[model samples]
Target: MDKFDKKILDILQHDCTLAVSEVAAQVGLSTTPCWRRIQAMEKNGIIRGRVALADPEKLNVGLTVFVMIKTNQHNPQWLNDFGQIADEFPEIIEFYRMSGEVDYLLRVVVSDMKAYDSFYKKLIDKANFADISSSFAMEEMKYTTALPVNYL
Candidate 1:
């Protein structure tokens, strides 16, 4: 990946819906070369996949909470079971295995406090977590799905 590839990645990260020609124009490349570069990136797994970002507020999902979880067991079977349970729960937007006092962290989204309470109950019932703590986001000052590409 060179400068042009990096530029392509930056543009795509902002909006993957841009046409190859549009991307080419923005990145100062002709259509064929630009398309080829994108194809190469996709083939090499540098460009994984594109997705749409939805407005949680507009969708009636106004509450966001970060749940820190400490599991009783760290065995492979327990991890697999937890993973499966998390996958089945739609309210869990993101789940990560972290390095800290907590074993896992989950980004949960729900309609309201009541909905979050129900989700929390469901979570505790579904998994064998030794400890669980939640931190609610009163306001989101800044949120972006895009990663910084300047490092590239």
Candidate 2:
């Protein structure tokens, strides 16, 4: 990717609904070249997919908690089991295998503390781990689903 490609990515990251002509205008490219650049980015996996951002509050999801888990077993089977359990839980919006004291980190969303409690109990019941620590965000100062384009 060149400067024009990077610019295209930056604009799309902010709003994918922009018209081809609008993107072309911003990137100082004609319609055909701009469309080709976008298509190339998508073909090469740079632009993975487009999605609509939902309002968590409007959806009645008022609480967000990060759960850090340290597992007792590091076997492949146990890891697979843990991943399967996480996939089954709709409340677990994001799960990651980390490189630190904690073996995994999970981002869980719920309606309230009561809902979080229920989700926590279900999580512990599903898997046996060495330790599980959680930190709740009282308020989100700033949140963005966009990726940083400075590296480009």
Candidate 3:
């Protein structure tokens, strides 16, 4: 991708709802070329998908819990079953398999401690964990979905 392509991506990542003409205006391209570039990016999987970012506080789910999980089992079957268990909990928005001390990490958000306790019980019932630790996020100083595009 060239400079114009990168500039287009930089703009889109911030506000994808902008019209192709608006994007063209910002990125110094005409409507047709800009629209074509966006379409091409989508087809090539560079622009994966767009989503609405929600406000957790307004949604009545203000608490964020970071759950660190360690497990003895490394077999594919165990991991698959664990994945299914994770899928069952929508509150657990982000799940990642990790290296070093923790086998997996989950980011969970809920109404309060009581709700989190309920989620915890449900999780323990479904999977086996060598260890699990949680840290509450008291405040979110900065949170953003935008990835750094200058590196590209």
lDDT of 3 by residue, 54-121 (tens): 99999988999999999999999999999999999999999999999999999999999999999999
Instruction: State candidate 1's TM-score.
Output: 0.96
Better of 2 and 3 by lDDT: 3
Best by TM-score: 3
What residue pairs are clashing in model 3?
A: none
TM-score of each: 0.96, 0.94, 0.97
Where's the lowest-lDDT run of ten residues in candidate 1?
A: 143-152
CA lDDT of every candidate: 0.92, 0.93, 0.94
| TM-score of model 2 vs. true structure | 0.94
Q: Can you write out model 2's per-residue Cα lDDT over 66-126, one digit (the tens) per residue? A: 9999988999999999999999998899999999898999999999999999999998998
lDDT order, best first, reads 3, 2, 1
Cα misplacement distance, residue 58 of candidate 2 (Å): 0.4
Compose the digit string of candidate 1's lDDT tens values, residues 101-146. 9999999999999999999898889888899999999999999877
**Who is ahead in TM-score, 1 or 3?**
3
User: Which candidate comes out best when scored by lDDT?
Assistant: 3
Candidate 2 ranges beyond 4 A from true positions: none
